[model samples]
Target: MKTIKHFLIALMSIAAFTACEKDGDLITLSGLEQSELMATESTVVLTQETSAEHALSLTWTTSTLTVSDPTMLAPNVLSTTLQVSASEDFSGTIQESVESSLSHTYTVAQLNTIAKNLGATPDAATPVYFRLEASVGANMNPVYSNMITVNITTYEIDMSIGFILNSDQEATGATLYSADSDGEYVGFMGATAWYSFFLEEGDGTVWGNDAVSGTAFVTSSEDGSWNCWFPGQGGCYYVDFNTNSQNWSALWIPTLTVSGDISGELTFDRPNVKWTLPFTATSTTMTIQVSGTGNQYNNATGTDDEAAIDTPVAFAQNGSYVELVSQAGDITVTVPQAGDYTLTIDLSDPTAWTVEAVEGSEEPVVVNPNVYLPGVDDGISGNWTFDNALPLYNEENLAYAGVVNVNSLWGYTINIERDNWSDNYLLDSGDATSGTLVFQGNTNIPAPTAGLYLIDVSLNGLTYNLTALGNEIWVVGLDDQWNFNMPLTATATAGEYSGQITFAGASPWGFQIHLDSSWNRYFGGSSGSLHYRGSNITDDASLTAGTYTMTVNLIAGTYSITQ
Candidate 1:
């Protein structure tokens, strides 16, 4: 009863362990939510002057701060015509109660001063306006603040015309003339100048079209201000002059040429060129054909005027990967791999060509590979032996009757044995004349001649003759105490041998009887052993005694003999 109780407890403990192992896990919670903010718009503006008593300060903030103030910015007349000073915190002359929110009112004096500077009169006909605009955060956000345009009679003058383009100037000696100040261009060959004149009608101003002739500088009087004038029905005008000649000099911009390394003694027909500006080349074959014109190019600044002409040429060889440039000929190159690779050029043809890695190159080049097979027999780029011996071959049928195909018969369960392995070597029976297994070694030993040889044995310390040309002999009834040393020999002798039979001990004595043909023979003796070497060649050949010539077939069977 106690043993049963113990077993029950063990079973319960096993069940508990299994339950704990299978139920060891807890629920896990995981997840996340994300929200994105858009980029804001960046803005720029120019102030009329730094004369306002209530100095304005521009404040900006962003999640990623990388913005610069006006004071820290460089002046680029080409990119921006207006210059803006740094913002100030001081508010001057404005009413004390006007400070609130993002904007404040200016005094009448400030407004008049600003207007005069902007070339605008205080009257309604030439009223000035206070312009207000907002900029995006420094994070390059796509969002923008509301734009404010307030037209007030009391306004500050804006000295900046905000003209981004420069006017063309014609000069002759000390005199310089500009087409923009002329109000209207003299008009192209068949063009005309026209304007919309303001007409007094009703309470507001009305306009009507008017055509005028002459080169007098006239602006659009429709708004009573110096606004640019338009010519023709479409209000587009162009300057036309028939001067003898106008010399405009431009700088020559250099183009870069890029190309991949090419291999072999080949030529790259077409190449390409790339420049900082668009250019049209003199030839269509030249890539990146585009033209660039500007005053910055007048003195041929930078690498202008210099052009690059590069093409891919190759002289591929065994070890070298080469690419040629059309401009510069024949440069040695090395590629990572052998197969198809590309040549990248800056100016010349950007495309690449397919190349093959071959052997026998004109130049001596070496390839350093990470991994390579050592001492191989197959042909490749590594060190492989070429003088190794080939499989053995036999010319004459020596072992079998008649002409023996040594290669076939020698391979037929043939083996060689030697007491000392110091001169060990394999005899290729296939290379023999009469299926004679040739012995070879690293030492200076004479190679065995190819011929038919019969394996013989001397019984009782005497050379015995085979019953047939290729027969095996075995002696029976020899005393174990006889001192007969067994000597196995191979010869072409044809005769039976008999002599004093001797043995060392009780150890059984035996000799191998090999046959040249496919036959079966048998042998058994009292108190002795018969070990036949040839396969199925021992059949007690029961060969009758007589001077008869017969084919000693390998298969075992007795037959009558005649002489």
Candidate 2:
């Protein structure tokens, strides 16, 4: 009886297993199907003028999702999204917006801005591609639609007409000067909305005026708020203003003409003959003596006084008018007495230039001999003070020369006044030491690298040069016991060194060339041609055990090893 009961239970278990298999088969046949989205339009065109009114629309069919269990009937929420991309592959500049309804619409302006934000040019028409995506429940499969292409035209602001400068003194449209696009017009102290004044007509006139105590010109709206105006009877002008710094300059359209005489007899000419006036920091007045053997003056004629009578002469003159040759007025100078006479010019007022005769002296102007290396980082801690500064003496070459141990790199300016940083000499182009130096507004000179170097500077010529100095050269390798102490000495010849060494070590042995028993300055490489402070030879040469001659050109910074 117990066995019969057990057989009945087994039979019941088999029946239950058959029912489960049949249910699984039904579920597989009725599995959930993924739905796809479709777009209403394949291509779209948009214009910048009416971008807000135009839009690209996309629509898609709803998707149906199913569950494995037939008894579990839960509602599935479908979420749809519209995506835009610059490329068909959707790899670059992609934007997506969630769709609440079956269709999504994007304004023309919105699409154009999106394209620009994704790296499209502002003024050009861009091709934009769009696609739709449909997603069911978190566990259900998502679907994608066919891609659509849209062409968007974007417009750029006309910067030429954005800002204009017009004065009440000038007729409407008669003298309307537009503002220049001189970068973003950053105003005084971070001010904004200030544009630079430019000329719309008549030689592109602009105004230049003092920012402080300058006249202000109002635009069309005279509501008490006005733009800065150019002082002095307004013709055509260019007004340059810095709203952030509150600094402004207004100059007449046509620059003022300035011409002067050298001895009440010589008249100045534009672009041809002009005296290059020299001035010192402390002197409120400047004097140029054009007598025999004095501060010589030249005219259209050559430097020779007798030759300069009828011919044009070129005189070195320095002032604000160096580039204003076209606008300066004719200036004349007359030399009454041929004897040594000094033409003293007053610098108090630029408008009224006066020259008077003074007694001339033949004494040579004495320049300070001691030169200090100011504004230099000497591998030490300090600011631009002269304390602990490097001093250079007048060498035989008439230039200040000295040897200095500098940091890996440094920048410095030269100065004759030991305590004054203002009276310093700097390079014409900042950080350029290859050219001549200037007394004012010069840039810092750079040191190529850290090492002992000989620095030579000529205050008179305003030029400088630097040379790296090395005391000794050594060749070390396995044959030299890999010790710097046991190295071959190089014989110096014409700024170069050459040495020969015998290598009896293993066929492939590493070797290097060092300077002064130190590795700081060394050269080693696979190529026969060497580089200063370059990498070492990783691949050892399989030279037969023999004597090899090595030559190093210190001045040229090259080396070679030959068997």
Candidate 3:
């Protein structure tokens, strides 16, 4: 016969029972919050002191009793059952909420394992409270203890700085750290951020991130700030704050200024202060002298302005000086050694000096008009109207007075300077206008120095033999009236040559070779021929005073006459 034995128990505060025979030894049990069944804590506070992020463990110790050994305590046969529940309140939620009511019997080994897995050592304070639970069949119960508290702390840092959104090179900023009493910064770590600046005048900026550390401040996007730094210390620098969520504090770096003047403490013997000047003159003679306040007064070789002009000017240490005498025009000087020097010149009256006398303190005296004496030519003087556009013909070689008439088609050598100019006719460098006009010798004559000249003409490749035509002079005039002497001459021979004789464009008509005395003129044809093109020849009426060449063929020609 089977007898039902009611085993009374508790599971999480609920009462229950299990049926079993007295001799069956089924070991019916209730859940146990504490393995040995003794508790001291009734509440737990999971304070901020818990460094561990997960759950905490609770435990207790007590001697157990068995039904069979009513007088003996069964520490050897300790049996246990457990139930668990979670709560938001720090109070005994394990009793208020019955998460699990079922009870499972635990062997002595199992009981110790449960306590060990819950982080319960022999006597660890384990300052968290959990309800003691017991179960038998469906019955549940909870046991409570006094309150226990735990302390835990967390770490946080604050960082602050300005954000440079636009990476402009001209815009500069700095990251500054708050300094301690000893000038050291607290928690000052490394930093990194991107930066960019212009590579060229109009190019896109180049950029990269840079990190640095110190109690000191750093410039971000350092640019255009007038500040001076040690070489290679400026430009642009990016920063990276190596900490988490911390802002990097910064400031726009201000620029600095430096100033000083060059002085003459720099002596010639110590270290030379070199200087030079460039110029051109009309005559072969000129004068140079250096005279100023400080080093200019020094006595030097080339510095003494005297006569017998020096080829390449030189100056020695001395007092200030001046150019008393020197070459006429421009002089170029290249200093091999260091020194100070000055230059000057005195230009002789150019061919015919035009004096625009403004009434001064003393009414300017007007000198007598001088006659133009061309060497080896008939001396003539008149108010000739001169064309300023002709190529450079050193007028110094031919002096003219009066209204100089310059009417002809002639290539110009154009150059203008405040002083006596030279034959500078070629176009300036990099000038594409009118292209380049090269002479027979590849000479680029821009504007020639202002002057007067005798125009010499050559036919074919040979200059005409002036003596062959009876020592008689023929004046080639670009006028139908034959009124003016066109400063023309000819030396001739015969060969294959191509050239254009340029006359002043002011002269309107074609060319006319007039016989000063009488002579035969020969041109394009067979031997001893006088050929005249229809376009070039007109009425020879103006030759009423001289002999002329006939257009018809000359039959037995070799003839010469003498008085």
Candidate with top TM-score is 2
Residue range 288-322, candidate 3, lDDT tens digits: 22222211101121112231122322222122321
- By summed lDDT, the worst window of 10 consecutive residues in model 3 runs over 265-274
- If the candidates were sorted by their lDDT against the true structure, best first, what order would they fall in? 2, 3, 1
Q: Candidate 2 on 335-396: residue-level lDDT in tens?
A: 44455544443322222224444456222232344577764545654565554232323222
lDDT of each: 0.23, 0.44, 0.24
Q: Which model, 2 or 3, shows the larger lDDT?
A: 2
Which regions of candidate 2 fall more than 4 Å away from where they truly are? 1-43, 68-72, 122-125, 137-141, 157-563
Question: Model 1, range 460-519, lDDT digits (tens) per residue?
Answer: 121111223323333332333222232222224322322222333222222222232232
Model 3 bad stretches (over 4 Å): 1-58, 62-65, 69-128, 143-148, 151-563
lDDT of 1 at 302: 14
Instruction: Judge candidate 2 against the unseen true structure and give its global Cα lDDT, from 0 to 1.
Output: 0.44
